[model samples]
Target: MAGNESETAQRLIKAFQQFRKTGRNEKKIAGFNPSEYRVLFLIQRANENNSEMKVSEISQKLRVTPPTVTQIINGLEKDGYIERTVNPEDRRAVRISLTEAGLKATEQARKTFNETILGLIDYLGEKDSEQLAELLFKVHDYFNQLDNQ
Candidate 1:
């Protein structure tokens, strides 16, 4: 059993390395790097709630530090992809929202990411793809629970 577990761990590590390498090679869209795209994606998600996101919220969702999120937010703001306003409810908190340009860039990034994922799904076949998604989600949940502890 221990040997099996070790082998499984090794396989998981190799898979992660390969995934990271492949992700790095994915075609860039909207002139954004992967990290920038992630910030845009998170802001886009927050917009779905019909409310602007706070800097701390973005940091939590991205599992990054507040300062890191602020830095990214600063760049996005400078690039005109996002706007920040003082939260009305909390004077000290800043709310972030995507501008029209940000929306366009986010949409383009989403399209490219979707296409790339779909291509991988095609290669994996429908059934395997579904299974992979289920397994990956389970893994994510397991790690998430660990993190909360």
Candidate 2:
């Protein structure tokens, strides 16, 4: 890249690093960390589709290993947020679904998260927020493609 390009890239990198740090310090939603919230939401979403999620399905969707998914599932289970059932058709497979508490927690977290995001959009104004979202998605896609290659 040219001199100007290099400087701009450096600034962008620094800005993103700052954002990551800020995110790390942000409060957990509804007493759940990001991963836990995601898992609960995934299970709830699957329930809405008239199905339950398997650990492998959650693992694949989260882009994490089975062990990591299992760890999260274990914690959620112990917390009474989720339940595991034997997949009748395939006795070897386990299906996961949210308990009432889990569903309630997930819904509250989702509501709060969306409200926060909507407030950000309001603060940024519609046009700027839209542009920022599009730009972020492009950045994500660029990295995703690079990783694939």
Candidate 3:
């Protein structure tokens, strides 16, 4: 079981490395690196859900540190992609939200992500792609369970 898990981990990492190659050629995802794009997407989602999230929330959700989130937020702010606003109810806490430009960038990133995944799905076929997705979810759930244990 351990050997199989190790092999799965290696293959998953290799797959992500290959997937990241798609980002290099994406001219639309300018100014933001892949990680930054991810942060933007998360912020967009959180906003849509009518609940704002702070840098600490982002760090926890993304499994990064508060300092790392702060750094990314700083860059995003400078790029006019996001704004840091103080939470009205909590003056000491601040939330991150996308500016108009940030929302546009997030939309472009979503398009890029969808296109890349669609290309992979076309190559994998519907049946195989579904199976792969299911397996990947199972693997993720398995790891989460282990982490909790």
Give the number of the best model, judged by lDDT: 2
Candidate 2, residue 46: how far the Cα is off, in Å: 0.3
TM-score of model 3 (CA atoms): 0.76
Query: Which candidate tops TM-score?
Result: 2
**Residue pairs with backbone atoms closer than 3 Å in model 3 (clashes):** none
Writing each residue's lDDT as its tens digit, candidate 2 over 40-132 gives: 999999999998798889999999999999999999999999999998899988888888998889999999889989999999999999999
lDDT of each residue in 1-149, candidate 1, tens digit only: 99999999999899999988876655466588777888899888988888778878878887899899889889989999999888788898777889999999899989988887999899999999999999989999999999999
lDDT by residue for model 3 over 54-106, one digit each (tens)?
Answer: 88888998899999988988998998999989978989988789999999988
Q: Give the range of the ten consecutive residues with the poorest summed lDDT in model 2.
A: 21-30
Among all windows of 10 consecutive residues in model 3, the one with the lowest summed lDDT is 23-32
lDDT of each: 0.87, 0.91, 0.87
TM-score of each: 0.79, 0.94, 0.76
- Number of the candidate with higher lDDT, 1 or 2: 2
Deviation in Å, model 2, residue 149 alpha carbon: 1.5
Q: Is candidate 2 or candidate 3 better by TM-score?
A: 2
